[model samples]
Target: MPVPPPPADLTTIAHALQERLGPARWFDAHTHIGQHDPDGMTATAEEILAGLDHAGHERALTFAMHEPDGYRQANDVVLEASRASDGRLLPLARIAPGAPGALEEARRCLDAGALGFKLHPRSDAFALTHPDVDAVVALAAERRGPVLFHAGRGIPQLSEAAVALAERHPGARLILAHAAVSDLGLLAEPAARLPNLFFDTSWWHPSDLLQLFATVPPGQILYASDMPYGPGTFSAFAFLRCCAAVGIPDDAVREMVGAQLDRVVTGADPVDLGRAVGSARLGERSLPLERVASYTAVAMQLGYRGVDATEAVALARCGAQTTGTGPEAELLRYVDGLLARAEERLAAAADDDAPARMAAVLDAVVAGFLAATTSAGVPPVAL
Candidate 1:
């Protein structure tokens, strides 16, 4: 089938920017393509790929969304897309934090060719910094994969919480969606500090993006279009134009589009490649649970109060209190005990009406401990 071209204006935007910024091919960092009906997004994998080809993007990290039980449907659509694209669409599996068989499902997705895990805290009613986040992170790391987290500071959102959670997982590479726009002035400090941290530009206004562009290194910035949420090609082309308009170099734009994201999608650590992306932050800093708790308090006030939010806050605090220096065995035991308790809670909730809520809380607590332990000098990947 012949792929469609973008709108004339969009093509112009890309060409104009390429002329100025030098022609560096781009890789879209984020995208969601699917068909939705009562049966969830019913689009075939080929249709989604057709859209990608039509967009003129070299590659993309494709994801999907639907209600709770729609994981299967969504996964099927994405898996098909991944297979058809032959790696152009890096299929990512979306799993509600508290869904039954969530971990098992993640494994299944990876086996079926998902490149990473896709988490939407807002829609799933959980926070990235939730305690159980470690389990998912651990699973991804075990597979030598990365995780892309949806981040934004709006209704039912927890962009701030998601960033905080990434801080805890040093070994788990994180893709922060929308780059928390709250503190534009200080965003670079955090971006430069987190070695495994990456950001995607999808919906921010030209001004906000320019502000971010001035501070954040291009290697950390990914060109993304949260399709179905944004104006698709129009929005993506506008972002590219804005990047060029802001005087960002052409090579930088290329890096933003795909060079950097390609590394993350392929799970290639810059450090391993001797790229020196950045030194790990929170290394010398004591990321006590108190700091996380303080943020959670403010977050709750801002309406971040869901099962995942509350549980992550509590677990971070508890993790800070429980684990301390001693024999390595002792530390491991302590963590094991904490995880065991979490499992008990999860087991108990299996038959509960609100299994997702209960599971989210448990996962949040685990993620909290993992973050806290990392702050105390443990590798975020240790979990």
Candidate 2:
């Protein structure tokens, strides 16, 4: 197979990690593929397929992006795309749990070949306290299909209700997307006890991923790329590196990457991969990379909030410009190369809003951050 390209190139780093990790099938448990999202993000089925191919993934479970005007049409679009994807794309009905006919819509899509359901309480503006949420989760439970919840950002503390639903319907495969960072600190302990509750690794940020792997059972963590938000190639790169950093065995890494998600979506019971690997297993740390992660995280957040991230980006640049030599310095210089590329893209943007350009900058920051993550294990060859 041909090697995928850089600036967030995976060849050198992934080669080492994959050699150690052995072979594993990748099932991307979370992805968004659509043309019209109110958020200005668009990903066609072809784009998602290319990403899966680039990452050497077998298939991806996808739903519509934020469809504010109801998801009936959006759901249909996804279903049609999946039907033609030759098993490479799996469609999930994006639903507003509180909306009228939500259950009916879910039933329709499920009967029409949807693998599961996607609920974004923040985007849909439901509190999860809505009476319909339980009904929807119960439906998933009855069908043995996975019910993925948006746990990235926004929204209030929702684990209480989620816990209640998971307990009530033992079969409901509950997935908290985006590393479940909204409540990761609070849910780590609870997640250990709830076998059916899972988290999707669809985020950037090394420490956040480090924490998730250290706290949650590997069985409950699934590989996912928020496609269009983040590409599968980078996700696979960072994920494998983190797994190696935490001293997680290749067997557990195999399940975390894809095996377990396949079972959940197919309405099959999930396999137990034993307990979490303690943080002690996390090998040597690089303060430089840690600072690089910090600055990039801030820059990306500022960009998302529609604020100028120039200062943060500059700080990130500074963080990546380490002096002297060795592993830490070498890694910083590699990330610095990627960061410079992001700045170049940002500088070339002359549009007033520069939405597309801004996305490019932020996406570059994500790439730089994740590329830094690979430094946690084997020092990545300079790109």
Candidate of highest lDDT: 2
TM-score of each: 0.62, 0.88
Best by TM-score: 2
Worst 10 residues of 1 by lDDT: 272-281
Question: Per-residue error at 39 for model 1, in Å?
Answer: 14
Task: Estimate, for each residue in 162-258, the C-alpha lDDT of model 1 and write its tens digit.
Answer: 4565666666777767754644454567767666767678653443555555566667777786654432454455555445434555655666667
Off by over 4 Å in 2: 1-20, 283-286, 302-311, 320-326, 340-375
- Per-residue CA lDDT of model 2 for 124-188, tens digit only, reads 89987787888888888888889999997775867787788888988889999988888888887
